[model samples]
Target: MSYRIRPAEQGDNEAILTLLQGTPQQGAVTLNFERQPDYFRGARVACEQPDVWVAEARDAPGKVGAVYNVGWRHVWVNGEVRPIRYAHDLRIAPECRNGMILHRLFRHLRKQLAEGEWMQTTVLQDNQASLATVASGRAGLPTYYPAGTIETSMLYTRQRMPRLPADIAIRQSGSADLPDIAALLKAQGQHKQFFPYWDVNRVHGDEYCYGLNASSFLLLRIGGELKGVLGFWDQKPIKQTRVLGYTRGMGMMRHLYNTHSVLRGGMRLPAPGGVLSYLSLHSVIVSNDDPELLRLLLDYAVAFFHGRYDALICGFFQQDRLAKVAERYRRRLLLSEHFLVSYDGDPRGTLDMNRPWYVEVARL
Candidate 1:
C-alpha cells in the first residue's frame, strides 16, 4: 500500500507511542519512563514541531508507521559557526517494515534534509536497520564515529588516574584552568567535522561547572601544567510517584535534552537530604601520546569516579584506542556499534567515520 508522509500532530501521540512500543526489535522496551519521560515526550514534541515528520500508510488512516525527529544546531568548525541538522530519533513500526515503506520514507527524509541544509544524523551504533537504510542511499556516506556503546566500566579510583612517569598529579580544576581546557578542546576541533554545542568554554561557565555543593571537574596536572580533564554532575532517579512532578508541563524538546543531559552527565541529580552517590566521568584526555600514558589517565579517571559514585559510565568511540584500554577495567558493554553522521562543509571532506576520536554527545 502507498504511504503518505506528513508532519505529525498532537493527536498522533498515542499511535506513535503504540508503534514505538510495538517495535520490540528496536530494544529499549524497559526504558525507565520515571527516569526519562522526556524521550517519549520529545517524540511527540518533534511531531508537533514543523520540522519533524511522520509517515502513515494512505490505506490505513490513523496508523502512524514511522517517525524522524530532526533538529538544527550551530557548530563551530574551522573557526566558524556552521548550521547542521541532527537526526535524533527515527523509528518504523514492525508492521511497516516492508522494504518499500523504508525506501519511500528515506527518500522523503533525504529530500527534506537536502532542502533544509541539514548535514546528517548521528545514528546509534547498534541500530543496524537505520545504518543500512542510510548507507543504502547514494547520498548517504559514513561521516563520523562518535563513541562506543555506553558500558559499565571499572569504578574510578585515585590510583587509576594517569600520572606522567614524571610529576603529574590529579587535582580539582579551578576557574583559572579554563584556558588550558580551551586549548585542548581547540586541538580536538581541528580534526572533527561537526562541533558539539557544549564546548570547554561553555562547560567552564555553566551552572554545572561552578559545582554548587557538588564536584564537577577534575584535572590531571604535571608540575603545574594541565594535561587532562573530566567533568561530572549530581543526578538522581525520579521515583515513580514523583514522575508527575517531573513530567509536569516540561516542554517536549527541552525535556528531551534535559533527560539526556542528566543521563550523559553521568551523575544523578541529588534528591533532598538523601546521600545518593554523586559524580560523572564527563571527559578525559592525556597529552602524552604514549599509549601507556593514555592508559594511566583512563585508569585514574575511572578510579576517581568509582570512588565518588555508585556507578561510572563513559562514552568512547569504537575507533578510539581508549575503548580497548577501558576494557581492562571491568567495563561492561552497554551500547555498542553506535553511528554518528555529520554534515560539515563538503560532504566528502566533512564525514570521516574511520578516524580515531571519541565524540561526546552529552557531557555528564
Candidate 2:
C-alpha cells in the first residue's frame, strides 16, 4: 500500500480519533485512550510545543493509518533547565501493522530530526511486540537505549490523613500563591532529572494546565514557609480512558472487585465501555526531595480529593524512593520501561544517571 507521512492538519482530527478508538491497548483490561470533542486540545496539554504527524494511504484518501506526536517542554536535565522531547501517543491501525509503514514513518521522522537530538518514550513491559521492533535495529530507525522503569499507580483516595506537626498546614492555594509554587518547584526540581521547570505563565496560560488554576493546587506550608505543592489536572473533557473489554479472568472477577472496592471505599472497576474517572497528579515538588514531605503532600491530596475522584494517578521511576510513598496506599500499578531514543547510537553512555528520573505522568 502506497503511503505518505506528513504533518497532521486540522482536518485529520476525526480520522485520527477513529484510529485511536479502533486500536484499544491490549491487556487484561483493554482500554481505548480517546480524545473526544477535540484531539488537539489533549495533545496541547501534553506539551506546550507539539509536532503531530499522521500516515495517510494514497488509495484511502481521508483515512489515517497511523499517528505520532513529539511533545517538547523545558525540564531539569543534568542540573540545567533544557528543552527535551517526549515521544508518545503513537498509534497505528491494526490492519496496517506491517513493518513497511512503520519503517517509512521512522524514515520521515529521522529526516526531520535535528542532529544529535534525543527523546524519551515508554512502552508497557508486557508489550513484547513493540519492544522487539524497537530492538530490531531496523534501518533508518532511532536507537532505543534502556533507561529505567516507571511505575504508575492509581492510588486510591479514601484514606486517613497522616498526623503532622501542628505548625504545618495543607490547603488549597490561591492566586497569590502561584509564584511561591513555581519557586518551590524550581528550587527542588533540579535534584530530579526530567522534572518540569515551569513558571507562573506556563501554569496559567499553557494548555498543559487546562481546566486548572491556583485553586487546583494543594500547598503544604510549615510556619508560613512553602514546603510542598501538588496540582490536580482533570483532563476528562478532552481525553478519556474507556474500558473496551477484559480478559476472561478479569471479567469473571469484575463484580467481586467492585464489591470489594465499595466496601473498602476504593475505586471500582468500571463496566466495559465506561470511562475512568480520575485526576492526573502533576507539578509535584517537595522540599529537599524529602520523602516525609512528599508523604504529607500526597496524603493531604488524597484526603482533599476523596469521594470527588476515583483515583489520583502518579508515577515515579523505580529508583525513586518517593515511589515508596504511593506504594503504601491502596492502588493499582502499571509498569513501563523508559528508553532514550536517538539516531546516534547509545546516548545513555554519555548521560548522567545519578539523579532519579521524574517524568510527568500527566503529560505521558
Candidate 3:
C-alpha cells in the first residue's frame, strides 16, 4: 500500500476530524465517535505552528488514511526545565485497519522527529489497541518506556459557611501567595516530565497547566505558614466537545451513587465523562506529611466551585499518599487511568517509577 506522509495542512482539517471519529480501537473517545474540538484548533495553521501529520493514499490522491499530532511542553525533570514531546490523536481509517497502515503512519512521524529529544504519550489503561500498539516492537513506532500509570479522580465538594478556628485560615489568594505557590508546585512536581515551572508573576503559565489569576486560585495556611494550594482551571472551549461516552457504564450508575452525595448535601457527580463543563484541580501542591492540610484544602475547593460546574476533575500520580486519604473521604475512584510513555532513554537519569509527578487532565 503506497501512501504519502507529510506535515498536516489546513486543507486536511476536515479529513483529520473525520478520521478522529474512528472505530473504538483508535478513536479519542473510548466507546463513542463524537467529534472533539479541533484538538489542535488555531495551532494547526502554518504561522501559528503546525503540529500534525497526515497519511494520504497515493492511489486516491487527496484522501487522508491516517492523522497524528505532536503536543510539546517545557517541563522540570531531575533539576532543570527541558522540552518534551507527546503523541496525540493517532488514528487510522476503519478500512485501513488491516495491513501495516498504522505502523507505516507512525514510522513517518518517527523519522521526522528531532534527535535526542524524549517523546511522551498517554493512553487509557483499558484501551487494549493503543496499549498493544505502543508495546508492539514490529509496529515501526519509537521505543517507549512505560514510566507508570496515573489516575484522574472526580472529587465532589459542597458549599458550607462555618466558623473557623483562629489557627485555620482558608481564603482566596492574593499576589503575596505567588512565591510559596510556585515553590510548592515545583516541590510536588519534581521527577515528572513536562511539569511546568511556575513564574512569580504568571504562576501557572505552562500550556498544560494554566492558572494565572488569584481569583481562580485558593490557598490554605496554619498560623501564617502556607500549607497547601489548589487552582480551578476552566476548560471552556474544549468542554462543549468532550464525549462522556468514554465511561458509559459509570454514567449509568451515577444516579445511585449521587443519591448518597445529595443526601449528604453535596452536588450530584457528573456521570464519568458526562462533564461538558468543569474545573480541573490544577497546581495541587501540598506540604510534606500534611494529610490534614490536604483534606482541608480539598474541602475548600469543593465548596469554592459548588453549583458552578458539572464536575470537579482532579488528577494525581498513583503513589500520591493523598490518593489513599482522599479515597477514604469519597471513593469516586476509578475515573480513568493514564500511562506516561517515554520514547528513548530519559536524558535526566531521573526517570524512576517512584518519583513525584504532576498528573492533571490537560496532560491526558
Candidate 4:
C-alpha cells in the first residue's frame, strides 16, 4: 500500500494520461487525456522544460495515483519580466485524497524548487478544497497567492451574427507568413502583464506550427494593408468541463449576470462531464488601434466555422488592449474565469486588473 512520488519521465505518459482520464468528475474539471495532434509540441519545447510528478504505488505497482505539471513561463509582470512556473494538471485519484499522499507529494515538490523561485498556479475560485490548500501553505512552502481573476469569454456563434466591417478581407496564412504573425503577437504581447515573452525564433520553427488540431491563421486586411490577425485552433478532443455548480461560490448578482448572458443566447451551456467541442480563437493581435479590427476577425471566424464547431473561446486579462473591443460584443459573450496567481504576492501591487495581463492559449 506504499507509494513513491517522483519526477515523471518519457515512458510515464500513458500512466499519466490514465490518471487524467477521470474515473468520473473529480471536481469541476474533466481534463482530456486525448490530446490533439502535436498539441504539446510548443509546451514541450518551452525554455524551461516541463517537469511532472507522478505518484507510483507499490501494491498495484505501475499504478499512478496522482500527477501534476510544474510548467515554466517567461512572463511580464509589473513592467518587469520574470520566470514563472505554473502548477498545471493536478490530478489525484478519488481513492487517494483521504490519505496523507497529497501532502507528501506537494512536500516533495517543494524540495525541487530553488531559492527565490516562485511557482504560479490557478484554480477555480469555487474549488474550495484546492483553494484551502493554497491558503494553508506550510511554512517555507510556496503558497499560491490569488492575484486576480481572468475572465474567459466563450462566445457561441452557432448561427451567423453579422458585424463584419465593410471592405475587409480575410485570407489563410502560410509558412511564409510566420514573421508577420510572430511580429503581430509580439506587438500585442506588450499590452498584457503575464503574456509570455515568446522565443520567436523557436516559435517560428516547425515545432510550434503543428501544435493544434489546426495550425491555422487568418489575416485581416483593409485595402491591401494588414489590420489584424487571428488563429483558428480546434481545441476539441482535448477537452475541458464547464462543471455547473463550480459557480456556486460567486455572488448571487454576478451569477445572475452570467446566467442571464447564457440564457439569452439559448445555446446549451456546457455541463460537468461534457466534452466541450471548443474551437479556440487565439493569437489575437491588431494594428491601427481599431476595435473594429477585432470585430472583423470575430465576424470572419463566425462565418468560417458556422457549422464546423459549437463554440468559440477567447479571453484576455482585464484592461488588455482587446478588452474594450470584447465589451462591444457583450451580447455574444458568456462568462467563465481563470485565475492568474503567484506564489509570491505582488508586493508592488502591480499585477492589478487595471494593468494588462496575458495567458497564452498554448499554456492554458
What's every prediction's RMSD, in angstroms? 10.1, 1.6, 4.8, 5.9
Q: What ranking emerges by lDDT with the best candidate at the front? A: 2, 3, 4, 1
Task: Show the colliding residue pairs in model 3.
Answer: 157-302, 244-273
Write one digit per residue (lDDT tens) for candidate 3, span 118-158.
66667777677777877787646666666556667666656
Please identify model 1 stretches exceeding 4 Å from their true place. 1-35, 40-51, 55-65, 73-81, 98-101, 115-166, 174-180, 192-215, 233-283, 288-294, 307-311, 334-346, 349-356, 361-364
lDDT string, candidate 4, 1-364, tens digits = 5789887776666676666565434433333433323323433633255677789997776788997777776776665667777777778888888887877877787677665456655565546677777678565445555555655666655355555457777878777766776776677666656766655445343443333422377898788776687877664434444333334434234446446545443234344444555577666777844677887787777657655665677876555566666565433443324443333454335454555556565446
| Model 2 worst lDDT window (10 residues) | 200-209
- lDDT for model 3: 0.61
With a 3 Å backbone cut-off (N, CA, C), the pairs that clash in candidate 4 are: 193-356, 193-357
TM-score of each: 0.58, 0.96, 0.77, 0.76
lDDT of each: 0.50, 0.86, 0.61, 0.61
Q: Estimate, for each residue in 4-123, the C-alpha lDDT of model 2 and write its tens digit.
A: 998898899999999989988788899888999788888888887888999998998888999999879889888998888888888989888964888888888887679999998999
Report the lDDT tens digits of candidate 1 across residue range 1-364.
6679998776676776666555433231222112122333443222222255788878888888887666555455545456555565567776678657666765676666553243444554566776666666345443444333433342333323344566867666766777786676456544444434345555433432332222356676768777666555443331111111122233234346436534443323233223334344554555633455556656565556654564455566555565666666543355544444533333444545544444443321
Instruction: Report the error of model 3 at residue 210, Å.
Output: 6.9
Model 4 stretches astray by more than 4 angstroms: 23-48, 77-82, 137-141, 161-167, 199-209, 212-215, 237-274, 288-290, 319-321, 324-354
